[model samples]
Target: MCRWTRQDRQRSHPLNIQRDEYARRRRQLMRMAGEDAVLLVAAAPERIRNADATWPYRQDSDMHYLCGFPEPDSVLALLPGRKHGEVVLFCRERDPEHERWHGESIGTERAVELHGMDDAFPIDDIDDILPGMIEGRGRVYCHFGSEPEFDARLLGWMRRLRQLRGGGVVPKEFVALGHLLHDLRLYKSRGELKLMHASANIAAEAHLAAMRMATVGRHEYEVEAELMRTMRSRGAVAAFPPIVAGGVNACTMHYQANRAPLRDGDLLLVDAGAELDCYASDISRTFPINGRYNREQRALYELVLEAQLAAIDEVRPGRAFDAAHQMAVRVIAEGLCALGLLAGTADDVIADGSYKRFYPVKTGHWLGLDVHDVGDYRVDGEPRMLEPGMVVTVEPGIYIPPNDTTVAERWRGIGIRIEDDVAVTRSGNDVLTANVPKDAGEIEAWLKRGMS
Candidate 1:
């Protein structure tokens, strides 16, 4: 078996995000917001993990997408064609005492020098100052309800500005910033793709490690620990809480309680990802607890893999957003009917949603910075067409819960999901998490040989 040390993990990944990348993103967003518009985006607020302690602060995805400033209690206001500057940042001020206890502050002075901001101000004066910036704008493109407290404050600013309309101009229009901003973010840049590729490779290694360590007697959390160690050792954090569901536990979507004991003949489904440099890669794999799968387990696993592969084929440019999901549903429904899990024809099962008994939700979702990343799958309530540069997950699953008496006893209590992160290209799709094997035969060989 191959042993991976933290030093090895450290050397495997390098960050590629440059300062200019964020600046370009800001310029792109400004183009979306016209000359007379002001786009207000707030930083993610601090939360109390416990008394006096705080949760690990992560910047808002939209805010971070435009400006790569990684501090808290900050806001970015982009005013195109403004006299002084286009990018104005409001952030915490420099306090020697506070810095001594907590950490360094990206004071207003350095915000302009280091982060390319046109002008900067202390967050202390936001209420008095931000409204002035908001005044005389034709359109206010802002995240209206992301931060409720900030939302109320913004409303107050708008109300106060409305009162002063005798001389001052309040924004005549309020447009949701996400509509335009998310669309910009939906397409990945070269830097973003590089980060996502690294994330996916790291996650693939973690999954292989988990598979190698898993045994009949080991607990689900024990396997989860292996995954965490592998990711953190590589300096990437999990995109989300891992779903290390074993046997019947796998039937529950979004299963978090990973304390179940691994059974000798049961399947262990692992759904996890690594987030490298704020870019996320999500992948899922299902394998037997022991080295190899049993007869019935292999049969069901192969069916899911078939559906997932067929779905991935739909992840190409000009295809509809739901094309992959529709493909997966058709394949899964047909496979189930052929296997006698469903009696009706594939078309009948799909039309009546009889396949929901085994397959519950759509195949997968968009994958990026946030796990369920920002992007509209629909425009004008119609399915949006998939385009080049969009990354999506192709996950098709079948869960036969233990209590459900619909299926045969052999088929019940078996759940399987195979997923991979695919980036849509002009010609086809690129699988970011391809290093991780979803095929039963390949997974068994890898597990037995250990990262060969």
Candidate 2:
């Protein structure tokens, strides 16, 4: 069962500088749109199993970025190029009857106060109120292909405006809001950094806990449960589904069944993270389930760990985004050649794309509010340069399938991945999740301590 501790409730770390930061982002987006107004909506309520059952609701990331409010059927409208032009939110009204079955609703009044909105109104009255807001506005800014329901509603509103063309009402243009917000979010604010750091710390601790709990005969799910418990105790949630693959299961990337029992000679690969204050931390670690790695497993693990460290060393401001990936690929290619897993020279294997037989996926990705954060790497359809305040994951792995005959029997089914959260800095990169024990010695020590 899920447990919520007293400390979770008592310790309140309300986000700081949230309002000002959000306002600045909205202003930038407004400037980019070159429009008089923009309209954005939060995620609508979703149906679950049946009409009687509904899924737990979470607000859209873009909406939360602007308003920091998590409620269903909410809207944010921004009017730009005008004095006193800012943000307004339309949300659910107060209803004591509905509150009885569900829970307390923030209501319109408190939403304006808490969310820093210029004005607030009941969401039910959107149709009546929106036309007035849209009137005389030349262009409307919103994300296309996001929400089908919202798309239908936007079309309906556009049709209504078209009907009023004879009545002296028209919209000259429709712009994609994604371009504006994506650009703004690419650079992390100080407030966002704090939350991301906290998330990294939490995820690091959870990984430590999983490492300590792992043992021969323990099911992978048991270790996953321990990690979940640790996260919950710290008032955090999983950034994604915890991947706890043991033995041959480790060869499968994105393996999350987590039901297999660990064996004496098997390796365990765990890819998990914690989400704190909506910011996410992604981390992965692989170790021996029996507290000591055999020679083959140790060699593979060290190579992968070395490749990860080499990649991380390349993370810095002004560097190409692909630098770390290239470094890791080179290291893995050389390692495979040394191990006789590849026949030809490292250069030949790498150039011919034969190295992908061992490492199929990219080394890592950007890590932030979402596990894979937004912001297209292309400016004008070109790779974006790395800059300060950007956070990313440096993970390098080598997976040897159980059925593969290229390597020795002992080396088969041994998969290893080492990941860490890195924040690009003015001088270099800071390892945000450094508190976790990652080195082979430190991991072994942690396991021993847990056994005692």
- Give the whole-model CA lDDT for all candidates, comma-separated: 0.87, 0.81
Error of 1 at 405 (Å): 1.5
Global local distance difference test of model 1: 0.87
Q: Compared to the true structure, candidate 2 yields what TM-score?
A: 0.94
TM per candidate comes to: 0.94, 0.94
The most accurate candidate by lDDT is 1
The root-mean-square deviation over C-alpha atoms between each candidate and the true structure, in angstroms, is: 4.5, 3.3
Error of 1 at 431 (Å): 0.3
lDDT of 2: 0.81
lDDT of candidate 1 over 311-363, digit per residue (tens)? 99998988898999999999989999999999889999999999999999988
Clashes of each: 0, 0
Error of 2 at 281 (Å): 0.6
Clashing pairs in 2: none
Model 1, residue 299: distance off in Å is 0.5
Mind giving the per-residue lDDT tens digits that candidate 2 earns over 132-167? 667788888888887778888787776676666465
